[model samples]
Target: MGAIGRFTISLRLLLALTQMAAVGLGGAVHAVTQLSRTDTTYTRVLEQEAAGMVLVTRAGLHAHNDSRLLQSLFVERDMPARQRILGERDRAQRRFRDAIARAQDVLPKETAALDDIERHFETMFDSGQRIEAALLAGEDERALRMLQEERLPAFESFRRVAQTEVARLHRRMDEISEEATRKAERAWQVTLLTAVLAVLLALFLAAWLLRRTVIAPLDAVAARMRALEAGDDRAPVPGQERADEIGRMARALESFRLAAIERRRLGHEARTDALTGLLNRRALLETLETLAGGATPLLAIAIDLDHFKQANDTHGHATGDALLRAVAQRIRAALRAGDIAGRLGGDEFVVILAGTDEAAEAVAHRLRDTLNGPVEIEGRLLRLGATLGIAALPRDAGTPAGLLEAADQALIRAKRIGRGGVGRAAARAG
Candidate 1:
């Protein structure tokens, strides 16, 4: 009972633990998915900001080229070319500012570096304005000298600063990407560890449960079943020890086995004569009736111990019983293999010889000779004689009742003729 209780409790505990493990695995998978999504989002934002920063640096370099062209146009005194260069300068400046604004808005964390870039662009713009003023005042040489010393140097400084900032942003992006990769790797490692542990635990639990719930019980029941099939009803039943469904099945099998044994015992008793260990009257008649339909020829012989009643009256019933047992043994010894002999109450006996009736006369003579010679009971040596009547199947009679009637008639004839003589039935139509 204690073991049964533990089994029940252990089953529930295993189920609970399995559910918990599933929940933990699901949570770990969800965490990994969320981490991957977050990393992807951060990477996209960083890439967009980096692209915008590159656009701003390119625009600044274009504006510086436009400014240098504008000073050359002024020295050539080409009004149309100067006007186009000025317009290009304004468009480039506007494009540069717009790109910077977008980069700054997209990546607010890089504000300090953008501020320094903005400062360099402002210096370059101021230098360009001074060069344009010299051109408007017709100071060509002065403007050319200022272009080399002030505007050129200012534009170079702006370009250098923008490129430096762009490199810095790229380095920052690389750092962010590396950190995200490391984090993703760590999350995957944890998830894999948790999943592997859960699977191993589940396998162990399954194996344990199978052994307890199925394998052990089935093995025990199978052994008992094998014993039952082998006709060993006395084999010990182990299901009585178990408290599960297997135990109930074992109990049922045990009951069935006992019932089968009892049924066999009853059947044996019904067909057997308790006194001489031979077939009873009803069983002998049934055997003859069953043999009546078969194709093989069989002989039915009726036997009677001569003066049996006189012997019982003179020597007592105990002596008669001993005489009957001796006579039955002698009859059995005279019968060939496959011959069936039985007692038909009192001192009368019947024997059926299988295969043919060719040896019927010879067998009857043998039985008569066997019974005529023996008896030593209560220290008294008494000699006995037996009379036999032989009836051949399909020759003297066909039906069991006909055969028995004919054999009885023959026995009557033998008794009339003399004691201890063998008589054969008269022939009849098939």
Candidate 2:
């Protein structure tokens, strides 16, 4: 698949798995926490019910004592204390009933311990009512006897039953707590296992993807660089399918290598002049065109070697070619970086000077003076003179064709005036 497609697929899969894991973990944690909180609330209710039963037992004992005190003292003021004790007992019974209702909501269906506790509370209430009625009827001995014998026995048994019920509820609560603990431990184990597996899967996928996309490509480029350094141009490397920046870089490098080879081949052809190695007329025209279009003003100096036909007659065509090559080298050495110096075949050469005046007279004078330097041919130095024709851009003519023609006319003028002299082209009027 394509690089982007592969990345997207991997990313989507990872995201989906991650989301699923998160949801599962969240649900599990919430269930565990809820169960734990419910267990705590149920345990608190059982304790509260157990406390209410203890209060009911104490109030029953106090009622029995108040009945005994009423019989022994027979004071009218003791009636209020008796009433307060009865009221306390009633409140405790009410609290016990409320606690039982709360416990029913929490405990499992029809619990045996809860049933026993309810039965014990009913018996205790009936015994208390009988004792209270006998005392109110002024049957003091009968009421005391009933409380000491029947009611006290029932209350004691009720306390034992309530204690047993509390113990049973506590046992059930402990069981639930243990079960919840086991469930929480299991959840933790599962979560840990899932997290470890996820990490391992992520690492494996990351390594695999890195190898496929990045590492492999980098290795290929490294191998290519090594091969290039070892001069093995034929070495094969994987090319990019995408048009991204890396692909563009590879393409650019390939183009540069090809261009370098082509440049070496062209350099040989460029060195030789078709007509004479004196730089062809095509080369001269190209140089003049480049200078004319420049932002800086330029002077075009056209030089024609003096008495070339007579020298050819005296020596040979081979001697003329040698002289031209020597002159071309000398002129090239004398020029600056931006200057253009080239031959127009036969015995003619051109020099383009940047930043020259409109008159072109200054450039002509410099060239005539510099050309006075000797030319070395086959270890023999020859002193030769040349005539120069100068034309400045925008002053002579605006276009390349006009500039060349004007320079040629100036050269003709120099030859007509005198050999080895400088001439300038007249500036054209707007």
Candidate 3:
């Protein structure tokens, strides 16, 4: 062939080989990454299922107490523990099924291994059921024998299936790796031939193209990582407009940022009290360390409804809950925005008064006046009353635990003195 024609043919062949290598490497990377994620998810689901199965089996084996046995066996039983076990079993089954479905989607070609595992799982489940029945029928020896003979064997078979599946995954990974190596070798040979041709201009063009198309985006991603570490979100990403891999990555990062913000918002909402829109006890304690700086006074007030139990017993819990909500609103209205009010639980509530030394009597009067009005619930006029116990910051206690204890003691004294009254924390008798 003519020298020009030969050179032209060689260049075309080199380009074709390079493109094939890039495509193969991209596909291999994607497949391996996807397989790893699927395996991780599958492992988690399998572990959960195994743990739940063991728990259910234990519950069935120990169903000796007649009342408990009946409660455990009956799905509609009022026993919460039994119901929880059943719920776990159902959840485990659903997860296992979902894992199987996902494996089918991701690894459709590995059907034989998946089918083996599924068949073994079914056998194990059947054996477990038979063992439970035997135990419930008072056949202790038979149940024990079945556990050893049938259940254990079935479980071992399931384990073998798991091992087989893992082996299959490893084999597939090796095959993919070998295929990638072969592609790389072929690309390298083409690259060597191109180098021998000494076409400086073409070499420079190809190198620049590779850098812009591949290396530049990778460098940008690395810079983004450093920016993220520095808590900066303003880093520019390449290929934001192009519908390529880099563009997809930029879109993913944006999604991640939005999701992170939403998660933080949700976490804050969960820790805040719904009714009073104030930080709940858990959130208050979390921030108490920061609030309780050196020499900073942290006053704690424990508030209680004098006859809350009586109110619930008489007017029903619905009315009682409404009354509590009303009391919380009144307290929030009275306290400054800097102060924290929380419903600890039930009718008992607390307020963390930062840098306050108001007397117990004064605080009690303020709260009483705030909640003095009658609350109407379901056309019934309900009169509400509250008792307060005040413990001064840095004077009565230092730590959150100490402040809570002191306030609780003061609240007990207040209840003893009068139903709807206030008391200050006093020195405890040794």
Candidate 4:
């Protein structure tokens, strides 16, 4: 009776929360649907009326250009010049015809404004033919009279009527915007009013559920989960010691946290070097490409262990491997959280500094000093040094491969100055 009594009280709280969420979700969906319908109406205007207007504008411009070209043809005494103008007019006619054909899509019932445009075009075209005939027959006075009386007036009428139609389309689109805006405002108001009332009712019913032990602890748990999701894997899931529902929930959340950590560990292992536990060559290249693409400043350091093969020959492979691991440890200690290091097979390693400032240069210098330090392996003191070649992104080179090549070249240049030295890429290009 006591156990049931303790849990039975939660039913009212659960019901209130569930109902509140349902109402909120429903209202939001409804509002979005209404807004979407309104937006769709506006999109229809763009798809239909605006599209038709573009065709109309283009056809009108070409027709106007054709009229000007015809006048030029009349004035041009050279046969070649007249012929060129005629060719241009022919192209203009083709373009105008194509636009009219395509514009049938937006015209009234699939023939919007096309009939009127074609009528005006035909009238002007007939007048242009008569003018052309008069000009070809060397009747200059007759051609001038035809152009003045027929072609010019027809073109004026065509432009005026087309402008009137465009003005009508503009007015229609304005009406559509006003109508949709009104509908959207009404829908948002209705949905918002309904949602607010339902949420208020839910708050009243849920007032009893907001105790410190239950609500506070649950809120803490939710916050911890959010932190964990945001990459703070160490965020603790508290309240696991409680002998209640909260404890059980805490235990479940702890399991999820553990699973997430394990998954991340596996992901790290996949990208990591098996020997040094740094990033492998493939991961290094991938990281380099990603950083190079971003806005952040970056530097690449190419490190080669000086006399590594000689060490292997003298100390055997086991000693050489141990020495490499030792160098890797020093390299890791010298890097910041944002920096990355990778082993590119035997004796070759790379480090990526996240900054371009002298602080980054300090890290490189520190790494070189540490790597140059001697090591005692199996009671034998052996010396190893690292030669470093460095390059800055978009300064020495722009691409990942180019940066790497420049770094390598710097390494070669540094090695020329003897082991344990640093070589930098060429001076920045202005």
Candidate 5:
């Protein structure tokens, strides 16, 4: 070809590349705008609407719980019982108020809804106080009538408003999800078109350019992101070494993954015992309190391993650990459905059963038999026996603390009486 022909061909290629660049830039700008909007909507839904909804729901539940506790006080004529219920009511109200305050902080735009929740909560709390006073004055009929007329209506109103707020939050979350989906689709379309143009332009250059540098890495990062969202944070993130925007994003996600893993580890360590993998004392007590506040029949069994220290002294710390683990396993195996077992430090363990005294006794017997396990150390056999103390809720005592106290007393009696005996707490005198 002539010099003029070569020059004209070069100019044509340059113009084509320039046009492709312009198109890609415009698509990039549009996609970025759509993604920004989607991100904002998603954050609002998660941080404000969804969090606020949960807090509101919790507040409503605690309010209803307080109402139930108050009603219990009306039936129990004993002063100590009244005081216990009163104390629980105060704790529930504190929790309810805390939840409401958190909801207000998150959903600051929902001021009117939050205000309604606060107003109704105050009304219900005040009515509860008045009814308590009526009961304290020995005016049983007046207390009952006031509870039915004043407190019940206020509680219903509080629940209604809370439910409405929850429903509104749900609707908002749904709308935001839909909007994000649409925006993401539009961005995907724009990106797809830009990719097609780049592919065509690459025909004049290297066809593999866009996929190798941009699309492939982005797809990998996005897949890893989806995995992270699905709660699988163990996978390594891609493209961290690249000195680009994608690299920055990948680095950020890796930090988040590491942080999540640390948080999970810390959470497990906090709740679980290091030796036996049973719930720790704090977690066990929290679980007990949650179950004890309800009307379900509960049984608290306190177990003390008989002659554990003797075995520990004879055999070594390793054999003692093995014995403890074997005993823990037996206790867990002996439990039925809905039963909770926890190590309360050293040779002390506790089991909370949501059943009758008969069921608890059967479990206690099974445990005493099962816990007599032999741990082999240096080809020798070492065994341990267990003693248990059983206490029933609302029969031995009403509250969680009282139940534990009764169970502990029974355990002390069991220890004094025999080597491996089961002792039951005496029924409460109403």
Candidate 6:
């Protein structure tokens, strides 16, 4: 064979080897990034589940204190308080069990702690029953004795165990979060290192392969970048299909871009309600604080869905969730362009209207009318309504806390009078 033929064959062989390495590196980077994301997701689920457990247990403890108060009040023949206490306890028990059930899917490391919590809860309930039996029998003395001996010890034990488990879960979550951060940093480092190696390898082979051909492939990359700058939504960078070094580089860059976008999307999801697509409690507070100095006269309207719990019980949570979304849509429609609305968890929402009481009331009435209309969900029409409480900024109160308090008081008044009624807050003292 001639010298030119041998050179051509050797060049082709080298290019083939380089292409194989590039494909292998690209696959490795993708696999590593995906594994890191999956681990992070699992950690987040554990953290959220642990937090829920803590919340429910605390709520149960609060109800236990209220039941103790009712026990004392029962001695005074306060039948109303007795009934309320029983209802509160029942709700508390349900909440505790629900939290436990939800936590059952948590990571194996948390299993033992959760099991201990469940056992403690059972013990507390057993003692609670004996106390309730004495109360029902009208033997106030026996109830008091049982409460001091059995109920107190059981509650104390449960509280201690539950709180310890909560602390452990919190620590585990912190560790997981820190580990996830490290993994993210490590993934970036690995990807960068691999890209640098690929580029160095490509440069080594550039002499054997025609320099013109090697450089020509980069035109596609430059075009991709230009498309990205022009904000083209049609596949910003198509990499991985080309067998050249430029293809590998584009693939790596695309991965980084996608990772950044995912991070931003996760941040937004954290602050937004999944059901209503509204700002959640933490985000709402931040938004309110941001408006503290903007345009002197602002109004806050606290809204609660009337009979929402009953509706959830009757029509199921799916329907109730749909109702919440429908109400959010109506509220948003009623507000002016600049107004802000947020969900404060459950069936509660708050709206910040940039106007006077008169304007706020008008908006409130429109919202009420919109919410009271029939909602069509899952082939069934349901009637839902809202009770709105309006409080004006600087007029009702100057501070955020004061504004919220005033609005809440008005909401209580609206609910007290009747469902689907609008209430205005009393003027604040200067």
lDDT, candidates in the order shown: 0.71, 0.58, 0.58, 0.73, 0.75, 0.66
Name the best candidate (by TM-score). Answer: 5
Quote model 1's TM-score: 0.50
lDDT of 1: 0.71
lDDT of 5: 0.75
List the RMSD of every prediction in angstroms.
Answer: 51.0, 49.7, 13.1, 24.9, 13.9, 14.9
Candidate 6, 316-349: lDDT as tens digits: 8678778888888888888888888988767888
lDDT for each residue of candidate 2 in 249-333, tens digit (9 for 90 to 100): 3443454344334444444434335333444455556666655666887677888888666655576666666776767776776
**Candidate 3: tens digits of C-alpha lDDT, residues 70-114:** 223322222344455555555555555556655655565656766
The C-alpha stretches of model 2 lying farther than 4 A from their native spots are 1-256, 263-280, 283-295, 358-362, 427-430
Residue-by-residue lDDT tens digits, candidate 1, 1-430 = 1122233333334444556676455655564565556554655665565555555555555555555455444533435546766776788678767767877877787778777888887887888888888887888889889889998887788878877887776677667656666665665565556565654677777677767765677677678778888887777667566755456446645655665575466567557766688987667778887877678877889999987888888998778889889888888999989889988777989888766565888788888888888588888888878898988777788677778778878898999999899888987854
> How does each model score on TM-score?
0.50, 0.40, 0.49, 0.42, 0.51, 0.49
Look at candidate 3 and give me any clashing residue pairs: none
State the RMSD for candidate 2: 49.7
Question: Candidate 4: global Cα-lDDT?
Answer: 0.73
Q: Which stretches of candidate 3 lie over 4 Å from their true place?
A: 1-242, 258-277, 359-364, 376-381, 428-430
- Kindly give the stretch of ten consecutive residues in candidate 5 with the minimal lDDT sum: 1-10
lDDT (0-100) at residue 18 of candidate 5?
42
Q: How many clashing residue pairs appear in each of the predictions shown? A: 0, 0, 0, 2, 0, 0
User: How do the residues 1-430 of candidate 5 rate in per-residue lDDT, one tens digit apiece?
Assistant: 0111122222234334645566545664565556555554564454467567767876876787688678766545546556878998899999999998988888888989899988999999999999989988999899999988999999889889887888988788677656656655576566555556653555646325445666677778889889989999988899889764456557656765765675566567567766789887767778878887567788889999988899878877777778778788888899898899988777889998887778989999998888776656568877778888999887898787788778878888888998788998976787
Model 6 regions more than 4 Å off = 1-235
Candidate 4 residue-wise lDDT, 1-430, digit = tens: 1121123223334334746567546655566566556655555564476667667766776787678677755545656556777898889888888888877756665364677877899899889988887887899899999999999999999998777776776677567656656665676565556566554666655665656556677767778878887878786698789865456556656755765675566557557765688887668878888777677777889999887889888988788778878888989988888888988777888988767657657877888888877888899878778889999887888787778788889999988888788889987567
Stretches off by above 4 angstroms in model 5 are 1-216, 219-235, 238-244
The candidate that achieves the highest lDDT relative to the unseen native structure? 5
The 10-residue segment with the lowest total lDDT in model 4: 1-10
